[model samples]
Target: MQMTVSEVLARFVSETDFSALNNDNVVAAKTTISDCIGCTVAGSATEVGRIVRRVAQSSGGEGKATIIGGVSGASAQAAALVNGAAAHALDYDDILWSLYGHPSVTVLSATLAVAETEGASGRDLIQAYAIGVEIIGKLGRAVNPQHYEHGWHATASIGVIGAAAACAKLMRLTEKQIAMALGIAASQASGVRRNFGTMTKPLHAGNAARAGVFSAELARDGFTSSLVAFEGEFGWARTLNARTVPDSDGLQVMLGKPWELTEPGIVLKRYPSCGGTHCALDAMIAIKDQHNLKLEEIERIDCDASPFAHKVLLYPRPVSGLEGKFSMEFCLAVAAIEGSAALRHFDEAWINDPRVQALLPRISFNPRADLEPAISADAVPAEVTVFARGQAFSQKVLVPSGDPRNPMSTADRRAKFMDCADGILETDVAEKLFNDWERLDQVAQLDELLSPLRPQN
Candidate 1:
């Protein structure tokens, strides 16, 4: 008899061992986790971070985990909720290409919180993370450009299930209990593209992370749910309107054969903005650097990308910093004029600056359906042309930097971490944290690593 989708996954999750993970994959996981911590710590001071922290504080239950960069503790679920939000608050966390979403914030936030709560070791957390990555990465392949095109936010829609899987692994639930956790997670999956560029966007990550912990804890206590919720008539795949419903047979065959975490790998961000805008930013920045181009020398900027990028980068004339992050026009213009679109650049004052406003209208975007077939969904292929100095200079980017094919160096990763960790942590503490993360697999407890991260009064 053929096994149900949940049964196949339950066996895979239950049977997988940390020792089975490749050394390179384990290194990738540590790098991704380190990047996530930097983002979460830096994001703690953001407006959205404060709001969630406030909510988590007021609704306090048993305090079992620490909120990164915050002074207090909360229940594992609540900490996951707030930390998940904080991690992606600046839209700067690591992204998995296959998942087509910010996977680390959603998966790590829940896994870390639960690890601390269960007194699980660092090795246990790593194994749970690998499990989550396997589930979500495969789901992304099964569902994709179609699922994303349907206006569903995969980070929340699919991430909740991955988070649950990670939490369930840490809890050591039986296969039946794991299936129940997945079913419970399916009901909670939600988030839409319509909410992009708003505070609610990051909230999706938090909610997904929280739901994972919630469902796993309930399932550990013998809570019941459908074993085949992924493929049932009213299940996640059908209900979410997946472009092509995933095949259980195919999914079962693919599990653990080639691990997803290392196959597509995670793409670290060079810019602290939406992934949609990176290709354009890369092309524009390259052109600017090559010619040492100045703003006045440019008459118009033309950018070409796939329709998916055109749609995600919806804002042509962004009025706020948050909106600026998603605007191709704003990001390219800033890169061309300012030479960098660093964290300090995406503020309301900078977004509404006279120079930025003047440059926005000069940039025009066009759809390039031709480039869609060759690249991954998260890989935005962009060609940017600048009509400057009465001459046209163009750069075409097939895969932006930080992509697996074009990976960031160890120095690049460290520089980014320090830039983010500045002001949030003392220099020595930040350096030590980064060093500690490099050897994270050997650490016994996550709390020992995270405890010093609490904001000093």
Candidate 2:
């Protein structure tokens, strides 16, 4: 019997077993949740986040869910959008570089909000997260490499599917219900590369998270959609991207084996810009510190990277903060000038500063097969160089900082949370969340953790 997307999604949720946790999936689960908390804390006070919260509140979405960055309450849909954006606002959150370019942010944000609303236990929250990471991350591989190449935001598109699955699981829907949830979510999936460098970019994440929860909620109440939504002639695969599709047994492959969250793994980013440009950022920063190259002595800079990365990051002369995140050349230029790039470097003033703007004209990048390392199907290695005092110095980085292979230390991760929490949560509140995250299973109420998510400033 053919199923609907929601049906399969509901089934995936019903099948999840918390106690049988795979060791690798558990770690990925922790890291991803840790990553989302850090990003949300950092983005709580941003202009974009505040406005969106107001908009959601104005919509009269009264419910039990605590909006991560909201002062009071909102419907599940409202919380998902706000928290989802916060999870990736700084771009320093952990990554799934080999998969959806970005994940966990949208997946976990929705799960967290819904979990809180459902009055779910910590163990249950953890289980929902695992199912989400699996379904979404695997779907990334399914429509992958090309899904992104087709200009679809995998984090938003593929992520919606996972978010719905996670919500369904948390709600304990039947297999038939999951298929319907997935089907509804499939139709709701959407995002475009064109929105990069704008507030809409992060909004994609928030919207998808919200959409996933809504899809699952509707499914649980007898709503239905097409389960084979992905395999049809004009379905997700055909209409969104026909260039490449997962094998015929795509869904069957690894349904409960070789978890995608563990195998391909996740990337933890060191910088706050686009993950696409981080390899180049790492290479540039390394070469600068290594050779002690001062910007005043530099004449020009050049870089090489994956064509897809270059396509998204082609904004050499970025005009806004959002554009800055997508501009490899611009980000590297600023890093060279400031000696390092961090959360503050993404401010509009820095992005539009005359020096950064002037330097933009001197940098360029193109496709380079030599930069490839096969980190996975989508590894993006980068090479960056600066011409200074008539001498050329350059460096190459195969991957960015946050990959599971080159994971950030616990201290580094904590520090990241603090950095993002600045001006948002009280110091004590931030500290408490990190210390208590692992023990979330022990707590019956999520309010204590969620209460501090609102901006303290």
Candidate 3:
């Protein structure tokens, strides 16, 4: 009999050693992990982060894992929940187009929690994270853009299974137990795009991270679930995805063939907004800088984006910072007026500014079938046309900054980390954390290295 999808994935999770990873894979894992920690620390200061942290603290267990900026620790599950939300709270976490979602938030959140609880080393954490990204990326390739287009939030929906696999690996679960964990995680898979512009958006990551850790722990204690949960008639692929494409059957052979982390790779965000907005933001910012166009000279700005971008950028006229992150109009307007859409530009004061209000009406975002490609290695391309001073300045951005093709410089990544860490951690402390994480593969104890994240008070 053929191995089921869940079993195949579990076997890969069970058998693969950290030694199988190459230098690039380790570097990729370290970069993404460090970036995620910075994002988590920064996001922990947000309203959603505070609320989730409070909830996790109230529903307590033995405190075994760090909660980034919390005063103390929580259970692994609770810590994953809080940290996952914080990682995505600013919408600043990394993205993988293969998953069509933020991958690090769920993967790192669960693995870090479990690693701390198990006293796992940095290499162990790196191994689990790599496996999680691979599983999520392969599974995503099998079902999306159908899965993503069907109103499912891939970050939460597909993320739970990947996180489960990561936690199971970190916990040293058997292959059968790992399969059970995937099965349980498949049952828990759910998050909708309808909640995109709300607090519930980050909660999706939190819920997936918590459910993943819980699923893995349950499976370790002999919780039973159908091993064929991913490919069965009423299973995850069939029910949630409607139908898996032909590629779904071939995923078993494809796992770690080249390692997902080193291939298309993860897209670290240049702006603290939706990934859908980055290409357009890049185009707008470029046009603004190239022309040195003043706000008064600008007549109108129009963005022609892929169907995926159109669906994800739902908020046209946003009322708050959270909504602003999903608004193409708001993102572009800020980029045009302020020359950059940094974390400081998404607040209520900026949203309601007279200048932003004046520009919002002049910006138009539309979905054009022409821009939609049959296959894309990165986020779909976007075309921006800015009309100003009786002249049309048009730029089509095929790849946004932070993409592998247009990778951010080391200085840029470090700057981003420092920017995210600015107010959340003191400068010297943040510097030490960044340097330590940069050498994560050399670290002996994961929790000890993360000690600075806890509040001194």
Candidate 4:
């Protein structure tokens, strides 16, 4: 008999070991993990992060896992919820094109929570995270574009399964238990694109992470679920994904073939806005620097983006910071006026700035089907035309900075970490934490490694 999709993934989770990872895989894992930690720490200072931590502390009771920036720790599930939300709150986490979502927030959050509870080594955490990302990326290949176009938020909908697999791996669950966990996670899978600019957006990631830990833990203790949950007539792929079903055999063959981390790779975000705005932001910033053009000198800025970018960049004139993250107009305007779109530029103050208001109406973002055929499948192309000083200057960017093809340097990554940690942690403490996390594979105990995440009196 042929194996089901869940069973195949469970077996992959069961069999893949740390030794199978190459140097590149380890480096990617470490980089993504450390970057996510920075984002989480930064996000923990946000309103949503504060709210979730309070809720988790009230309901979760005291447990083993550390909640970054929380006054106290919570259960693994609760900590995953808090950390996952924080990781995505700023929209600063890494992105995987294959998954069409922020992969690290879900996978790393659940893995870290479970790893701490299980007293697992850093190598174990890295192995689990890589395996989870691989599973998510392959599944994405099978159902995405269709799945995403159907209004599902892939980060939460797909991430739940990846998080379950990673948590199951960390907990050393058997293949059967892993399949059961995936089935349980499938039932919990849900997130919609309509909630893009709200607090519910980050909550999607948190909920997925929480559900993943809950599912894996339940399966380990004899929980039962259908092994064929992903392919059953009333199952995840069939029900959630319209007109598309995953090819289990093909996906199994492709798993870890070249490792998604090394091939297509993760895109570490340089700016703290929606990924859709990134290409345009890159182009606009470059044009600003090259021409030394003042904001007032520009008459109009036109950006032609992919269908995907047009769909996700929902806000035109945002009224709040969260909404600003999804506004291509706001991002480009700030990038032009400020010369860069940093995390600080997405606040309400910036959103309501008179200069920003004046520039907002001058920027236009539209979907162009023509750009789709010109670039690779993974490329996010943005053609920016700036009409300035009665002259038109144009720049088109296929791949923005921080992509594997055009990677960020070690210093740049460290600088991002420091920037994220600026207000939340003292400089010395943040520096030490970044240094320690860089050596993640060598850490024996997660507790020791995460000690600095808790705020000191």
> Mind giving the per-residue lDDT tens digits that candidate 4 earns over 334-355?
9999899998998999999999
- Candidate 3: clashing pairs of residues: none
Off by over 4 Å in 4: 373-377
Q: Write down the lDDT of every candidate, Cα atoms only.
A: 0.86, 0.76, 0.90, 0.90
Task: Enumerate residue pairs that collide in model 1.
Answer: none
Q: Cα miss at 250, model 2 (Å)?
A: 4.0
Tens digits of per-residue lDDT for model 2, 38-99? 78767767877777777888888688887666755678888898888867666666667545
Off by over 4 Å in 3: 242-249, 375-377
- List, residue by residue over 37-132, the lDDT tens digit for candidate 1: 889988877998999988887886876788886754579888899999999888988788777899988999999999988898888988899889
Candidate 2 error regions (>4 Å): 1-10, 242-248, 372-378, 455-457
lDDT per residue (tens digit) for residues 125-237 in model 3: 99999999999988888788888888999999999999999999999999999999999999999999999989999999999999999999999999989977888778898
Query: Which of the two, 2 or 4, has more TM-score?
Result: 4
The TM-score, computed over Cα atoms with residue i paired to residue i, of candidate 4 is 0.98
* TM-scores, one per candidate: 0.98, 0.93, 0.98, 0.98
* Better model by lDDT: candidate 2 vs candidate 4: 4
What value does the lDDT take at residue 430 in candidate 2?
79
